[model samples]
Target chain A: MPEIIRFGDRGILVNFEQKIEAEINEQVIRLSEDLLHQHGDSLLYTIPAYCSLTIQYDPKRTNFKALSGSITSLLNRTTSPATSSHRKIEVPVCYDTTFGLDMVEVCANKGINSATLITEHTKPTYRVYMLGFLPGFVYMGKLSQSLWCTRRRDPRLLVPPQSVAIAGAQTGIYPSEAPGGWNIIGRTPLPLIQPDAEEPFLFKAGDLVNFKAISLQEYHEIEEQVKTGIYNLKVSYGF
Target chain B: MASSHLALYFAKPGLFTTIQDKGRFGFQAFGVPTSGALDQAAADLANQLVGNGLDQPLLEVTLMGPKIQFQGNGMIAITGADLSATLNGDRLAVNQGIEVADGDILQFGRPVSGCRAYLSVRGKWIIPTWLSSRSAITQNGKHLTPASIVQKGTTIRIDTSLVDPLRSSSAAIHPPETDPGIRVLPGPEFDRFSRFSIGEFFSRLYRISPDSNRMGYRLQERLSSFSPEEELISSGIIPGTIQITSSGQPIILLADAQTTGGYYRIANVVSQDLDILAQLKPGDTLRFSLTSFEEFS
Candidate 1:
């Protein structure tokens, strides 16, 4: 059972566990979905973190006491483990010299050649833990231990859009041009976030992602097609 | 149907200017920051003075102030910061509804007091909203208004049809000139700090750093250092949550703070007192007063 603590007069924080774990994250998402199901009108929204869920409510419509009671009851009812029905997304990356800014530094730090570094980086199917900091900037984690490296001592003033970067045990693609500290390893041309779309961002939490190495030419071709809103990347559960 | 819009052209957009309403809600799960008026009380007062609903979008001016030309006639109210303002060469009154004549140039001079100001018109501005908010310059994938900074060529469309009966009467408030000690409550990781560190936090006067922006206000002084044995996992964060960085300096997250953070949050600023922090410019000195939950609860 999670410990429900008062976040503010209008919010509540449900702490599932103190530490970060995949199971905890899964439970957080599951409980969030359940709460959304149970009290759709009462809650303004719920923020599901790695090990906890924070919910904000309408002060006039619902208070902490009533909302927490419903949440606790919902948690008690849902005993089964999370099904983890997350979709698989395949993203293509071009680690060419022109696009990969920190390739040399990252490869040197990992004590591996460019090809070996690329191979190891693409092998794992990364999970989308949560999207924060920037829109469509997926914070995925558990990068190969050998591939881990310290973050930039001095962050770049501007990192271009679709710049796939890594730092420490995590990796993600910058959805837009912004200042960032992560080490850029490659670039993906896909527009992970479309501001005009009803659902701006492409992926949600628990989505599994696999990066495929593509040629620079292919990256540009996909970029052109994506700009026209006609390109759709291949996503399959079995793959 | 009546168009009910008043368009204004910006000639000078001061240091920073953005459109803000009450706040953007129900999108924190996707990591969207709750972009809103930095000083909610001022914005609300500005809206009320103009006889508009509290949730109406208003211009939030920071530091210096914007120079604008009203394209249509409407009642306008200026509140919060006393940005020395003049409408068509006539000294503008703060916190009072003044009718703007078409083609009248409204310009703000050097800030007389306060760091931010609110400009509320009687009707609505026809700006597009993202994630159910009109607030600007956030990381939440919201498209920046063409002016974004209320640039020279940008024209903001507003509703001028609604006549606020209280248009002639002026409402004014004298914001305190002296530094009012900020009130704060213990944060989630408040227990992790040593008793001495806590004492040091409240005892020392802190200055707002130059690097501060909409995302957060970084304080200049470093607190007593005590590195935690364990890393704080990335968790939910709200505006006014003061998180200490690795260097032991405090950063008070503000209107545009990210929805989640991975730092040890030592305290959170109460909503009522947040305006005091908002009015503080860089190099301004402020001290914290340990406020109990009972006062706020």
Candidate 2:
């Protein structure tokens, strides 16, 4: 049984095993979806992390004892993973020197060329674990051991929006300009967040992402098309 | 138009002024930070004094306050910190509703007690909202990276003609707490640290570091040499979580804190005491007092 602890006065934290395995996150996400569906009226929000799910509820509406009891019952009923729609998204990345700020340093450290870096970086169909640190920033992971690299020694004060960066086993695209310590290897022209849209974020947790390398010319072309709202991202749903 | 009758013409925008309300909820799953007023009580009081709803968007001024000229007549109130506010060369009191005439210039001086002050004008504001919130994500709430800072010469419009008149009398002035110790409950990883480290965390004095901001308050004092036993998987965190870093210093996450973190969460400040911490400025000294969930509620 997962441990359920009180987080502050208004939050309840449901913790799984302290590991980064995909199966644990799957359980966390499943619990989050079930909790939302079952107790949406009482919950203000829920944050699903790698191994835990934190639910913030209204203290005025329901106290901790009642809420935790309901959560425990829900967890007990949950025996199998809930089957839901998942998406396979192919994101286009430009690995040109102009946009990839620390590409050369990363290549030199790994003793590999830019071509090899691109091939290895784009090889995996990464899973979206969780989104945090910034709005719409999707944390995807499980890069090949050969492509794993440490973060930058000196973090950048402001990484440009849509910069695809890697640190340790994790890779993420910055939805907006933010201070980041990750090593930038490529840039994506697609806007990751549109606040006014029906769905603001490009990728939700539990989705699968694949990167496709494109030339700088194609990047600019796609950028312009995106600006005109004519470009369509390669996406397959119901995975 | 009603906009012309109710507006604030800003001649000087003080340090770190932003529009804040109760905050944007149900969006943490999307990695959005809750970028609202740091002090909820003060924000609500300001709105109440101005005859606005409790969740109405109001201006939050940090340290120094703004110099606003009323374009037209409207009821306004200033609460939270007493920044020596003035109206056309006359001293203005906080936590009270006051009427302003056209061309009346309101200015603020040095802070008297607290770090932040809230200002609310009588009416429904005409500000644009992103993701169902009028709160401006200026500093740590940079999820959208919108340059939402209230700059000098900016004008804010309100529909004062539509709202009802103020009915309540002036609110009583509630001063900041004199106590230096913040009450906290043990977190998920409270037992992860050594007994000595845990004792040091509760007993030692910690000053708020200069680098502290809305995201989190970085404490200056470090506990006697200790590091996390193992790397923690990134997990959900709330506003008052106290995460101990590799260097042994503790950081209390605040209003604009990220939804998830990988550091060791030793404790979480109770929700009621969060307002006390919000009024604190940089260089303020504080200690932690362990409390039980039964006592906290």
The lDDT values for all models are 0.81, 0.86
Residue pairs in clash, model 2: none
For candidate 1, list the clashing residue pairs, or say none: B4-B159, B5-B158, B5-B159, B6-B158
DockQ of each: 0.55, 0.70
RMSD per candidate (Å) reads 2.3, 1.9
* Residue B193, model 1, lDDT: 93
The candidate maximizing TM-score is 2
Predicted candidate 2 versus true structure: per-residue lDDT over B169-252, tens digit per residue: 498888886646899999989988889888888889888999887889999988766777776888888889999988888999
- Per-residue lDDT of B130 in model 1: 72
Predicted candidate 1 versus true structure: per-residue lDDT over A24-55, tens digit per residue: 78878887888888777878778788788888
Query: B1-297 in candidate 1: lDDT tens per residue?
Result: 576668888888778788888877777887777778999988988988888888789998987888898887778889998889899888888888788878999989887788899999888667787777777755633343333346656788876675445533566586755656998878778888999889999988898899998899999999866576666778888778899887789999987888888888888887778888888888888998887766632
The global Cα lDDT (0 to 1) of model 1 is 0.81
User: In candidate 2, how many Å is residue B279 off?
Assistant: 1.0
